[model samples]
Target: MQAYKQSLKHETFSYLPQMTPEQVRRQIAYALAQGWNPAVEHTERGTPAKESYWYMWKLPMFGEQSVDAVLAEIEACHREFPNHMVRFVAYDNYAQSQGLTFVVYR
Candidate 1:
């Protein structure tokens, strides 16, 4: 199933714990190609929350790709950033817009 819903809006971002800063940026770009929004470090996390979380913007069809259908492609992209927690979301896009942000993780 797709990681995101067609009518819901979601956003997610995070700092790569096991990845280089450049790797993080590349990962986000891969996500966008597959339909996802990547954000930079927490803009409001001056300190720390219960569990450090990154802010992000999500589209309606961020991850609607099917496993049996898109697994190959997804896996190929996943190679860009290994050993890292990935944040993904899908939102509804009524205007058919392709806006995305690929923020590098530190």
Candidate 2:
């Protein structure tokens, strides 16, 4: 008999304990300090491999200095899509690519 292996999807900050609201705010603040734009995205299925499409909350908040605004947007997204997985993304304009991302709500 062959041994069974279970595969689990892994993401950034997955190993850490569930983040509190304050922790999330700190992350957003870090992104802003790094000069990265903050954005919110959600996926119904919440499977990054299978669910290739993720809907953006509104738009990438570029040049945003207010961590409160970013946190508010994250909360709003979660409220609107309670069933979906909400994620926080840090986009780097200079690199023209995503810098960091983590599932904020699952």
Candidate 3:
């Protein structure tokens, strides 16, 4: 069997559309549906009223360095809207395995 780890760190982004939390949750779920597993989700919000500072993300470790594959999906999703930003850090159980992505929705 293959052993892998999925880790995600969330950071505040600009103002999103609506239900930013749910949107991120669904995004993670969708990624899991894409031949990925052990998905981990994390979220952080600046302030309730701060529409431009909500964050959520998904981490998928496919037993290999698949940052490009994972980020590609997320990038495509965020690109759908002209005003959506996403940021996250991905890593494995090892300190040597880690990646960071900062997508801005401007």
Candidate 4:
């Protein structure tokens, strides 16, 4: 008989405590003040894998200047994926693909 080996499971990265609506709003406002465009993304909570890549719910856009607009999008995403992890991403025009991201809900 041959002995079988089992693969070990690893935990994924995550914010220990999720942020609230108010906290998210403040973050959005700060990002806007810094000229960063807001975007929303969500993914099912699980180990990181090709399929676990963040799915964009809304592309980063500057047309809407108000934080409320970004907040609205966040709310919409929450409704769509109430059980999954949702994040707010702020992109700096000069930074191109680089951006600040944080988990707003999970």
- Local accuracy by lDDT, each model: 0.36, 0.83, 0.41, 0.71
Model 2 has an lDDT value of 0.83
Full candidate order by TM-score, most accurate first = 2, 4, 3, 1
Cα deviation at 33, candidate 4, in Å, is 0.6
Choose the strongest candidate by TM-score.
Answer: 2
TM-scores across all candidates?
A: 0.27, 0.83, 0.32, 0.75
Instruction: State, as a TM-score between 0 and 1, how close model 2 is to the true structure.
Output: 0.83
- 57, model 3: CA deviation in Å? 4.6
lDDT of 1: 0.36
Lowest lDDT 10-residue stretch of candidate 3? 5-14
lDDT for 69 (candidate 3): 57
Per-residue alpha-carbon lDDT of candidate 1 for residues 1-106, written as tens digits (9 for 90 to 100): 5464322222333322444645644544565555543222222313334124544322233344443222333333345444322343322254344344322222
Q: Candidate 2: where are CA atoms >4 Å away?
A: 1-10, 46-50
**Residue 102, candidate 3: C-alpha displacement in angstroms:** 3.8
Query: Tens-digit lDDT track for model 4 on 2-105?
Result: 44322222112142345566776887888888887888888776655632478999677664589998888888999988977777888788868535777777
Report the C-alpha lDDT of model 3 over 23-91, residue by residue, as the tens digit: 554554443444333222322333334433434444455553354555565565466533444444344
Q: Which one is best on lDDT?
A: 2
Give me the runs in candidate 3 sitting further than 4 Å from their true place: 1-59, 62-64, 92-106
Pairs of residues at least 3 apart in sequence or in different chains that clash in candidate 2:
none
The better candidate by TM-score, 1 or 2, is: 2
Model 2: weakest 10-residue lDDT segment is 2-11
TM-score of model 1 relative to the true fold? 0.27
Instruction: Report the Cα lDDT for candidate 4.
Output: 0.71
